[model samples]
Target: MPGKSGEIIDYIKNDLERDPQDIKTIVVTHHHFDHTGILDKLKKITGAKVAIHSADADYISGEKTQHGSLFMIPIVMFMKIIYRSRPVKADILLEDGDQIGDYRVIHTPGHTSGSICLYNPINKVLFVGDNLMYSNDKIEGPRVVHEPENYKKSIEKLRNLDMGVILTGHEQPITSGANNRLDTFLTELYD
Candidate 1:
């Protein structure tokens, strides 16, 4: 699910309310509004550093427009007009294989030209942001892609990895045997 700002703030507030001593870090897989909506608020509330891939840095820094579909143009225009663009700066710019806490950055672009995934080797969890989705016990490739070839390559890369849990940005989260399902989907793409 796209982490909205209000929801994210509430989530952090609840976390801190439960344990004020806990360390927090908001790891955004990309700069999409849905993923970044509460980013600034979460950073302020938890005093957590925001991390994003360097390839998307320009877009987040307000230097470039966010890549969006033609269908999303009206909504983007509305957001630009109604909401003052509070350009967010990432505390840490990530690179492929870079570690954030227990998670490793996986540059899986194509969904937005700068998309990424977070993989935790110990937990075997893959936090894929829109690069992949789960539905009906299956792993589905991206619904939209700015670069189809790159997206396909990303899916193949992820399929090769050892993952047990697939936490997608949308739809239900897959808890077990996710890697196998993802591999099947990738293989089918070739056939």
Candidate 2:
């Protein structure tokens, strides 16, 4: 959903049919340029508090550079050049298990140390970042991983949640029997 600053503002008002003023918080799942590109301007426009996981907060704040991944360099460079991506300070530095609105932050690292998924217990809906992507009507692991062990552990932990719907970073939402599909994937993963 992240795009150029003005594009996001326009999408919020036009496509989503919602006023920008109604946005209370800008929750970034990670510090990838594509995701955080609009954070600064969107926050200013909507006056929304920006939140990011503590592990990745420095990346967005310009306190630390994003390390690891050769594939990211070109994309990052492009975003910087075209979208004018820049660091934006985070108002809330989230930790694992932190609650934001109805969602609980689940720190799912590997793709990035600060990668997280927001889970709404009542709705059984999970918003997974690049750690897990929806593609071809199924869930697939991220294209790049920074920590393999941590990534496996993160996938293992997701099995504990009673999930019914999965809204990943890409593709359409998996709205039915997500738990079974995920468990199947986990079985294949461990086996």
Candidate 3:
């Protein structure tokens, strides 16, 4: 989990209440605070195993140094506090093709060097974390907050998938039939 706090757990609890048995595993697209904020708490509450990419296991497990931009300081601090209060450990180390429930984990490294996206082919939904961001009717490349080249590659990788919905990590969700929009945005990045 990202921060492993109580507020995040409440949000998950409400969702679980709506469909208690529907969710099988709690998958962390990456170790970012916003995505993983309630991971450990949710796991304890739901008894569902927590899954994260193996590449990020060390970072999330506090075995490696956490590096990021100035804006990420708060997240790092939050993580430190959470870890101090209640240390968390991932129950499952996920791989590129590992399936969690109906979604497959696609390791789209760029945003965090170990970032991932959960692709559900049946629903044509992708839970992409910082790989792409949507704004003003356009699904564009991620902000130049980290490695721009890797970010561009990740955008291209995600664009090739037959996705109907793009659930980004930081912004509002992008609806179906937006592949062309994403393609154009990625093309602009390449150009």
Candidate 4:
């Protein structure tokens, strides 16, 4: 969520330019700083209900601390300083198959205990938060350090989806044959 707050605000208010009153909810896929950089401010400006998976609700609420590996401590500290994720309570606690509007929440925990992906079956669009990533013409697990077993299980769970396109939390979108790519990643992962 760490970026120029003004740019994000302008993008939401001017680029998309939707009425603030019309924007109802801000969905967070995980508690990571990169994805939540401007969350606090964005919610303030849009007055949207903040939704997150229950497993990570405590992290954002400042009720629990995020513990990472020794090597990642400094990096996490730096991100905390840079992003300043202001603690906020979650308005909605999502679980697997929970529907919010057109999207269905998939609890894909690995990169974090509460990592999630939103799948819109009607549109065949999957909003996959860092559960997976695209790199070097290949779909792979999260680039960041994560819980390996949980990540694998999460991928296996997602492999069932008949997705047309995949929009990851970061980087380029997979616009064609996303399910195939996921299959390949799964096969490679299990092999």
**Each model's lDDT:** 0.75, 0.84, 0.72, 0.84
Of the two candidates 2 and 3, the one with more favorable lDDT, higher being better, is 2
| TM per candidate | 0.87, 0.91, 0.81, 0.91
Candidate 4 displacement at residue 73 in angstroms: 2.9
Candidate number that wins on TM-score, 1 or 3? 1
lDDT score for candidate 4 against the true structure: 0.84
Which candidate order results from sorting by lDDT in descending order? 2, 4, 1, 3
Error of 2 at 150 (Å): 0.5
Local accuracy of candidate 1 as per-residue lDDT tens digits, 99-171:
8878888898788767888888898898998888778778777777878878778777787678888888978
The C-alpha stretches of model 2 lying farther than 4 A from their native spots are 1-3
Specify the poorest-scoring 10-residue window by lDDT in model 3.
15-24
Instruction: Give the higher-TM-score candidate: 2 or 4.
Output: 4
For residues 74-151, what per-residue lDDT tens digits would candidate 4 score against the true structure?
Answer: 886677676775778899998888999999999988899999999999999999888888877779787774677688
Measured on C-alpha atoms, candidate 1 has an lDDT of 0.75
- As for candidate 3, its clashing pairs are 2-36, 3-37
Tens-digit per-residue lDDT, 1-191, candidate 2: 24667777788999999999899998999987767777777888999999999999999898987775687677677667676656798999999999999999999888889999999999899998787877776777887788788988998878888898888776688888788888877777777
Model 3, position 83, has a per-residue lDDT of 70
